[model samples]
Target: MTVDLVVRGARVLTSQFMVEGAGVAVQDGKIVALAKDPHLPEASQVVDADGKILMPGAIDAHAHIYDPDYTHREDWRSGSEAAAAGGVTLLIDMPLVLTVMPELARQKIEVGERESLVDFSLHAGMMTSEEHLRRMPELAEMGILSFKAFTTKPFLASYDYIEELLIRASELGGRIVVHSEDDQVIERGVHRVRDVEGRKDPLAHHDSRPPEAEVVAVARIIESVARVGGYYHVAHLNTARGAELVAHAKARGLRVTSETCVHYLVFTKDDVKRWGPYLKMTPPLRTKEDVRGLWEALLTGGVDMIATDHAPGTREEKEIGWDNIWEAWGGIPGVETLLPVSMSEGLRRWGIPPTVLCAALCANPAKAFGMYPRKGELAPGSDADLVVYDQNLEVEIKADRLHYKVGWTPYEGIVVRGWPVLVTVRGEVVAQDGEPVGRPGHGEFVRMGRWR
Candidate 1:
């Protein structure tokens, strides 16, 4: 049968392996066939990949974009543009910056339908209070597949609250994702350095959020999950010890998974000293040894996936921490560079196989977030969202060339060898040559199913 489009002459990544000399046929916004035999079906359109790699579009499961309160930093339109430019076809947004109540989640979904250029979903934020916890099942019934919680101040949930949320989530068949950090440990660290003159140093930010804080919180959350029996995911995990705790938890068969961002695997505390607020993120960058351990974990299955944790803030907002480490915004603009940076460092420098990278950036995230087969696979019946990557395209990253409203990137000047030249979301080319060609409001709010 004739198809809508065919992408030929590329190595196509499937769930099991990469198929060389393969072509993908698309129809009605879904994959119809992965052609390997000489004879091919007639199609209305054909894209010659020219030996580039054709894989399912990357799904960033962690990102903050277009909080109604922080539109100056990033909005849904701009954030989706950046995601398209980075070859991300879908991004699941974190709710910390946005309203996470059920009504707000519905409102954001409406906004995304009118503003985003890529498919998206939102996680409901679990608050520390009982009123919010009472709304958990309502949020789940509204199609939010997961809830997000914090264990540190400004967003911290009490241990009892966390336990209640976990139990409720288990009952609702919903998952919980957490920004795990021990509030008390961090408080002590802050108090220990509160009067010290050295507290002004950017490294002091790292000091305030020690690795032990994450390790302690991760262990606590795992135990809570084990006791309550629900699917749990840790967001933007930063330390090796934290990874170890997740690994051990998984060994016991607790429905737990964790992910680390590109920065944590690429940068260390040394970068915080060099780039200051620009490099600062919650949980902070760790030691070089931790970086090594994270990479090892990625390769060894200790980590489930890699995400951008793409939170962007204006230069002025970041500069607030220049005189005092505690005052700066704690995020980096990364959705536009996540794939390129990881491809360069993970594949070109570290010799990581492309299949492994695909699993981390595409497959694993889809599976974890209940968007698999539809968003992360190229097999027949899956949505035809794909990225055409040229592994030899060498380029230096610069904020001026990026699409973030924040106007800067922590990865500026870093050279990356591989880059996405063309990106398609559901059989339509949304971006090419690092620029988004799709219009605002073209994207739809994706409703995720329950995770098994």
Candidate 2:
């Protein structure tokens, strides 16, 4: 068979290990060979990759897309465009918007198919209604990997309902992604702050939804999963204490895993004063020690992956100095900045190995989310999703330079080392330098086994 392209490189990250001074041969949309001297007998095109790292394309594993009315922050087109520029070839979108169910999930999938510039997947949510719960098997039959549930409210499912949902999902051999925050603890904290400070200080926003709440909720969620003998993943664990709880649960032989966002790894509570709304993610950023804890957890293998938690609510919804903390919407728009910022600041300055990046950012997420060898690794039979990195490249992040609809970034002034010079999705060069070249609707939905 004639290969479509060949990439000769300094280093290529493969499933088992890295290949130095090797070449990757691709045919159709799959990698055909990664050999030291294999002849490209049927090669059609070859690209010289001197002084660059060729790695598996990034899998963001978390995001929200096609949130049109709400997407002044980020949408399918802009999010995938940003993902391509960030070296992310595939991204899994979360379900929690006002429109969320199997049909709505499929509609969003259709919207993403029309707008996304890279490969994508949609996760159906576990809603509070019995009708939605009864449709679990149908969703599983549809090949959605996992069901998402939140332990807290406003729009979250209750503990009783979540437990039942987890049981049903496990019965259907599906995974569960949960946002674990003690609703009562957060509510009490909010009430206490409202009584004392009357929401005068914006910092009280962080103060009210304290880290202890996350700790309490994480432990409880782990126990609930343990009781059901189900696989449960904690999303965007923001504190050292919460991560430690997850670490403990995993050590206890429970099938528990957790993630920390780039913001938690890079920013701290002090940023709330200066960056305010930009830093206001749910389970907000903690102290410098918390940052240290998350890093140590990643290095020591406690944390499973890194995700953007890429919730892109608009600036108008995030105004600070509100008389009530509840009035200020939660979350930050950040999918576009996730990789470059992490590589430049976290990996380069902090000495995090590229293998760790591959695992947390690519491999582990793929395995956990059921994308596996297809989307996460550079090996035979894997989709030809690859990124070429110019490690020595430096760029200052400016709002105008971002591709996400949310034009601004929290790390706007941070000079960053390393840039994705080229990106490929399924053997096609979709992004070059700083621009996306792929057309809308070129991206296709990827399906996973019920729990694979």
Candidate 3:
């Protein structure tokens, strides 16, 4: 029987090891074979991947796409196109869901099915009320098994509520994801920065949500989840203290995992001096020392993955920060640059092997979110989601070249030494040479099981 496609002449990188000079065979949207060049099966379609490193298409664990609610900032098509261009095959969006019941989940899934160019998943959240808490099992049955909560505002769930969330979710075979920051500490710091100090500087944003706040919140969640004996993931961890806390929890077999964003790894508090409000993210950029600590944790296995947290804000929304940092939008666009930039920097600066990148950017995230075996592996029976990366291509990031509704990138002018020359999802070529070729509606909504 003729296979649908054959991809030859590249090094295959996976979580455990690299298969040098291997080829992949695909049929019916699944990987059917992986072997050396001459041993690969002849197929209906043959694609050359010479001089490239082939790996599983990245699964972005965190993204924000507010379609009908805030389409001026982003939508499914625009967001997923950016993801495809970046060699990401899946996007797990974080809507900051205040209450994710069946109707709301189905409504968003319908939107994604109609408009996306890549597979997608949703994270339900906010266990502040009995109504919200009661939906966990029902939502899990529908495949939205990961729920999110904020330790601080705009939708804060108190520590008591979060502990209850951890217990309840574990009982129902679900996961709890938290945006960690201590509310009271943030309140005091905000008063210090904006009211007492009368500072509206970009750095003031960092000071207003200090590292101590993250440590406090992370510590509370990790320990609380440990007491209940369940899975917990901390998002966008920015401080060395936070990393240390997560590392210790992991050492104790607490079943806790955490992720850090590319911004935290690349930029720092010092960058605010130049980039100003563009660097303003919640759990804002930390010191260079904190950056080093995050890198250390990542390298040592204390940190499990790296995600874009790809949120975008219009120029008008972000530009207001130059005059009043407090007023500028808190997010920046990143989905388009996540893979290319991270692969380039991770290899060039930190000696991170391609296999490690595959682990963090591909496999580990899939395992954490229960998309493994199907979406994040290159082995047979997995979806033929692949990225062909050229280690030698050098490109500078320019906003015009990126696919964000926002017309700016904080990474503009930073040259990346490598790029994804081609990308595919489920055996179909979706992007090539930095351009997205995938069509809207080609992507389907992905259902997930809770990962134990």
Q: Which candidate tops TM-score? A: 3
Per-residue lDDT of candidate 2, residues 323-432 (tens digit): 44466767776777777787777677788777787788778888887778888888889899988887788899887887866566777888888878888999998899
Q: Residue 376 CA error for candidate 3 (Å)? A: 1.4
What is the lDDT for 315 in model 3? Answer: 82
Candidate 3 lDDT, 217-254, residue by residue in tens: 99888879777787888888888888889889988888
Ranking by lDDT: 3, 1, 2
Worst 10 residues of 3 by lDDT: 95-104
Model 1 residue 83 lDDT?
96
TM-score of 3: 0.98
Ranking by TM-score: 3, 1, 2
The TM-score, computed over Cα atoms with residue i paired to residue i, of candidate 2 is 0.95
Error of 1 at 285 (Å): 0.5
Worst 10 residues of 2 by lDDT: 318-327
Better of 1 and 2 by lDDT: 1
Instruction: Quote the positional error of residue 418 for candidate 3 in Å.
Output: 1.4
Per-residue lDDT value at 366 in model 2: 84
Estimated TM-score for each candidate: 0.97, 0.95, 0.98
Superposition TM-score, candidate 1 onto the true structure: 0.97
User: How far in Å is the alpha carbon of 225 misplaced in model 3?
Assistant: 1.8
